[model samples]
Target: MRRRKRRFLFSTVCTLFILLAGLAGAALFFRIQGKIGASRKTPDALFLEYVECLSKADYTDMYRMLDEQSHLNISEEDFITRHKNIYEGIEASGITAQIGQVAEKDGEAVVSYNMSLGSIAGEINFSNQVKFRKEKKKGYQMVWDDSVIFPELGRSDKVRVSTDKAKRGSVFDRNGLLLAGKGTASSVGLVPGKMSEDSAGDLETLGNLLGISADAIGKKLSAKWVKEDSFVPLKTIKKVDELNLNSMEPREDNVKNKEFQDELLAVPGVLITDTEVRYYPLGESGAHLVGYVQNVTAEDLEKHSGEDYLSDSVIGRSGMEALFEKELKGTNGRTITITDSYGTVKKTLAAKPRVDGKDITLTIDSTLQDEIYQTFKEDKSCTVAMNPYTGEVLALVSTPSYDDNDFILGMSEEKWASLNDDERKPMFNRFRQRFAPGSSFKPITGAIGLSTGAIDPNEDFGGEGLSWRKDESWGNYYVTTLHDYSPVILENAFIYSDNIYFAKAALKIGYDDFMSGLDKLGFNQEIPFDISVTKSQYSNTERIETEVQLADSGYGQGQMLVNPIHLASLYTMFANQGNVMKPYLQYKEEPKSEVWLPGACSSEIADRIQTALGKVISSEHGTGHAAYRNDIEFAGKTGTAEIKASKDDRTGTELGWFAVFTTDPNLETPILLVSMTEDVKDRGGSGYVVRKDKAILNSYISGGR
Candidate 1:
C-alpha cells in the first residue's frame, strides 16, 4: 500500500513540471518575432542612417552593409574613384537626410528621404533591403542591397542643359544641290554585362549574319568586365540592312524552341539605337571639297570637353568642310528622366532642345568643276577656275581623287595604303602649291615697264639675239639677229618674247620699280579665299651680268614661282580692267556673316598690258600663235622654263606654260585661262607639249557650251 502511494505522487509532479516548461518556450518565440517585425518596419530610418554614413565617407561601414555579390564585385579603391568627387562635396556641405516612408515588396524594402547638401537641396528616395541566409557555424546576418532610386528634383537653377533633339544640318553645293545630309543608318550594339554567358555562341552567330568575325564577337562579349557602368556599349555593327536582320538563323538549339526564343527576347543587352549618319550623293567627284563625317574618337573627346560646343561626333577633315567647321557644327542637346529600380518611369525631371547648324553654299560651279576634273583626269594635273570680277572660284580640281564615301563609313587598311602609295600624289592640292610661272609672267613685266614710263609702245631696243660680255661660257655671247637692227617696239618685244628687248626694258625701269609692280599685283600677300593659296616669290637683284640670267627673267624664268590661282588672278587684271576681286568660296542666299571687298589696280597700266598681250597672240612672230582661233581675238603667251639648266648650260628639261585672255566686243563677259605642264620631251621649242587639252576645255566656256 505504501509503495503505490509514492509512485503516484512522483508521476503527478513530473507531469506538471513538463507542461510549465512548454508554455514558457512558446512565449519566448513570440517575443523574438515581434522584435524582427519592428526592425523591418523601420527601413526608412535605416536608409537615412546608411546615407548619412556614406556622406561622411565611412566606406568600411558602407561595405559591411552591402549585399554579398556587390561586396565581392566592388573594391574600396574602385568605389572611391567612382563616387569620391561627388560624395566629397556632399559631405563637405554638412548635408542631412530625413526619411519619408518605408515599404516592402518581393522580399525587398524601399525608403524615401529628403536630402540637403549645402545650398543645393534635393530629394532622394532609396531602397534598403536586407537579405538573410543561414550560415554553417553562426546565425543569419543582414546583407544590404546597393541599388538606389531617386525622386524627381524638378527644374533647378543649379544645372542648365539643353533638352532639345538635334536636327542635323544639310550640306549643299554652290548650286544648292545636296551633297551630304543626315540619313538613317541601321546598327547593332551590345551591352556585355546584361548578356548571358550562354548567349556567346548566339552572339557569334549574329555577328556572322552581320558580316563580322567570330573573334570580334567574343571580344565584344568580354568588354563589359572592364566597365563601371553596366550599360556601356562594347561594339556597334553598322550597315545592317533589312535583308540581313530579317534572315537571322538561329544556331542555338534553345533559340529555335519557341519558349526559349521568348526568353532570349527578354535579354537586355542587344539593342538598336536611332542615330544620324552622313550620306554623300556625289560620292567621289566632290570628295575633297565636301569631305566626310565619322564617329568621335578618344582623341577628339579629349580635345573637346567641358565647353559649350557640339559633342565630338562628326568633324570636317578637309576642303570647305574643314574651313567652315565652326559655322557648320550646331549645338546638341539632351533630355533626362528619373526612374525607379525596376526601370519604371517616376517622372521627367528636365529637358533641353538642340539647335540645327547653318547651311553653307560655296561659290563653286558644279559644271565648271566637272570640266576641270575631266580635263585633269586625262593627264595628272590640277586646275583652278575663278570669276575675275568677284574672285569667286568656279572650279577647283585635283586628279586621281578619292571617294569621300570611303572616309564617311571607314577606310580599310588596304584602301588607305593604296592612297598613300600613289605616285601622282592625288591627295595633294596642286592649286595651292608653287610652280614656275614661265612666260606667263612676261606680260606683267611688260606692263610694269609701260606703266612706269620706262619704255614707249613704239620705241624699240634691238631684238637681235642677246649677248653678255662678262659671261659667254654657255654660248650666251651671241650678236643681234640683224646688225644695226630697227628699234624693237614694246609690241615687237612682247610678241617675239625677245630676251634682249625685255632685259633692256627691266634695266631701264630699275629693280625697285619692277618689284613695286609685283607688290601692286598682289604678290607676297595672302590670296583672300576660303582655301589656302601659295604666295609666289620673285628674285629682284640690283646687279645683272650673265646673259642667261637676263634671258631667263625676261621670259618668266630665273626664280619666278607662282601658283595656278595666282597666275589666273594676275591675268584677270587685263580682263577686268585692273580691278582684282577678293576670292570667296561661301556664296550668298546662304551667305556668311562676313563679306570681302575687291582689290583694285591701276586701270591705265592694265590697258597697256592688255595691248601688249593682244599683240603677242595676233602678231605674225607671236610665241602663242598656236592658241589663236577665228571666233574671237584671243591673246596669250607661251613659256618654257629650263629646269636643272645653269646660266651657262643650255641642256635640261623644260616646264611648259600658257596663259590667255579672250574677249568679244559683242559679249559682256571676258574669259581668262592659265595652263602649265611639267616633264615633256621630244618636241619642238624646248621639246615639250603645253597640254593643249586645257585650252580645249576652256574653249567650251568661252564659246558658252
Candidate 2:
C-alpha cells in the first residue's frame, strides 16, 4: 500500500512538470511569431524588399508581392515585359531606393519612396508612392500599378527611349571618288526563348553553314537571361552574293530539311535583318589612307559619356578616319516616348533630329594612286609623287600592302595575324620611313656651296680620282670613294655624280656653313601636312670630331636620313624658283608658297642649279639619262645608299633611290617624283630606280591614266 502511494505521488509531480514545460513552450512560440509578423508588416521593410527585387530584375518575386487586385489586372508575362522594356530603354547601370514617409489615406496605408537609376547619360530620379494592404496569411501585399515606375505613368502609358541613328559621312578622294560610305548587309539572328531544347541542334547546323563555332552561336544567342521578344545577332554577311546555300547541309536526323537555309528557317524565331554597314569600294588600294570603322566599346561609351554616343556607335580605328573622327561622327538624336504594354507608341513626347556628319575630301588622285599601287605590288618599296609648284600630293604608295576592304568587311583572325607577322610588314607605311639620301642629296650640297660663295660656277675641281681626303694634318682619318672622271669640271661633276669633287667642295664650304645650310633646308624640322612625316636626320657638326665625317656628309654618305615625301618636296625649290612650298592635302585652304629660310638661294643661283640638273636627262654622260623621253623633258638625280648589316661592317645592303621633277608649261603642274627600294633580287643600283621613274613619268605625261 505504501509503495503504490509513493508511485502515485511521483507520477503526479512528473505530470505537473510536463504541463508547465508545455505552457512555457507555447508562450515562446507565440513571442517568436509576433516578432516575425510585425517585421513583415513594417511598411519601410516591405517597400525596401520590393525595391531590391526590382533592382535585381526578379520579376517573379516582384509579381508575387502584388495584391490580389494587381494579380487580377496584370498577367505575369505582361508585368515582366513592362519591366524589361523600361530597363532596356534606360540601359540602367545601377539603381538606388529610399523610403521617405508612410501615411494613412482612406483607411489604406501608403509609403512614399525615392528611386534613382544610373545610366550612361546620367542619373534618372523618380518620386512616387507604393500602396500596401494587410491581409490574412499575407502580412503586407503591395497594391502594385504602373504608377510605381513613375508618377506620370498611367494605366495605358509606358516609358521608352527611342534612338535616331545618325548618318555617318562619306569619305572621298580629291576627285570625289567614294572610298568609305554607308551600305546595307544581311544579318543572321536568333531568339533564345523560341529555341526549344529539342530544336537546339539547329544552332550547330547553322553554325557550320556560317563557318562559325556552334559554342559561339550558343553563347551569343543566350548571352544573358533574355525575354522571348529579344533578338540576338549571330553574324552579319556584308557581301550577300558570297553566301552559298548549296554548300550548307542539314543534320542526318533532320531528313525533311536538305540545306541549312531551310533547316535554319524551320527553327522558330530565326530571322534575317538588313543592317547598315560601312563599305570600302576602293578595296585595298586606299585602305591605309582612308582607314576603317568599328563598333564602339563599353570604354568608348564611358569616355564619351556626355555625348549621345551609345555602345552601337561606330568609331575610327586608324589612318585619316581616326585623325578626323570628331568631324566624321555625326550628332546622334533621341526621342522620348510613351508606349503601351505591347510596345505600340501611344504618344511621342519629345524628339531631336540627328545631324549628319560632314563629308571630307582628300587630295589623292585615284588614277595616279592606282598606277603607283599596282607597280609596287610585288616590290618592297615606297614612292611619293606631288605637284612641285602647288605641293599637292598626287600619289603615295607603300607596298606590300593589305586590301583596306578586308578590314571593313571583317578580317579573319588568320589573315590579321598573317599581316601583322609578315616579314615585309605589308601594313607599315614605308613612304614615311627615314633613310640615307645618298647621291640624291648632291643638289642640296651644290646649292649650299654656291650660295655661300664656296664654289664658283666656273671653278674647276679634280674629280679624276676614286678616293679623296684632307692633308696629312688630318692623319688620313677617312677617304671618301667615288667614280673617277678624268679632269672633271663642276658641271661635269654634277652630271657624272663625282663624289670626290663634292667632298672637296664641302671642305671649301666650311663645316659651319654646311651644317647651317642643312638646317635651312628643313632637316630635323617638323613638316606640316595631313599625314605625319619623320624629320630628316643629319649629324651635328658640333658633335662631329673628325674631318672624314664632314666629307662623308657632304656627299650624302654619313648619318643622313630622309623620307620620300619630304625629299620630293625639297626638290620643289628648283621648280618653284627657290621657293619651298608647304605640302598640303586639303583643297579648301589657300596655297602656302613661300621660300624656306636659309635654304632658298638667290634667283641667279637657282637658275645655275636648274641648268646643271637639266643635263642629267639631256646629256649622254648623265647618270639619269635613262629617265629621258621624247615627249617628256625632265631633270633628276640617282643614288645607291649603302646599308651596313652591322654598325662596324664594311659592306651589306644597297638601297636604290631616285629623285626627279618635270614642269608642265601647259597646265603649270610641276610634277616631282621620289622613290626608294629595298635590296632587290634582279634589279640593282641607281639604274633600276631610274627605269621605274621613267615608267611612272610616262604615265603622267600621257594624261595620268
Best model number under TM-score: 2
Q: What tens-digit string does per-residue lDDT give for candidate 1 at 1-705? A: 899999999999998889888888888888888776545534555555566776787767666555455656677665455345434422234647776565556555555556644411222233233344323222232343323312332212112122454455667766787767765443455656566666767676555444457677667556646452344332332333344334566334323333432333355466555455676655555666666766566677677764323454677778766676666766656534444555555554334456677877777766666665655564445566655555666667666577776676556677788988998666766667877766667777777777778877787564454443224464544322211234577766667666566666666677667667777776777776677778876653433344445445555776677888877777776666666555567777643222232334467767777777777667656677666565567666766666765545657766666776665434444445566665543444321323463355444546532
Q: Candidate 1, which segments miss by more than 4 Å at Cα?
A: 1-168, 182-214, 217-284, 307-312, 336-338, 342-350, 466-487, 540-551, 589-601, 615-629, 645-652, 662-670, 683-705
TM-score of 1: 0.62
lDDT of 2 by residue, 243-328 (tens): 24233763242333224445556766677677877877655566666678887889988887766777778888877678778888
Clashing pairs in 1: 162-352, 163-351, 163-352, 163-353, 164-352, 164-353, 164-354, 460-488, 461-488, 464-481
Error of 1 at 299 (Å): 2.8
- Report the Cα lDDT for candidate 1: 0.58
- TM-score of each model, in listed order: 0.62, 0.69
Cand. 2 Cα-lDDT:
0.75
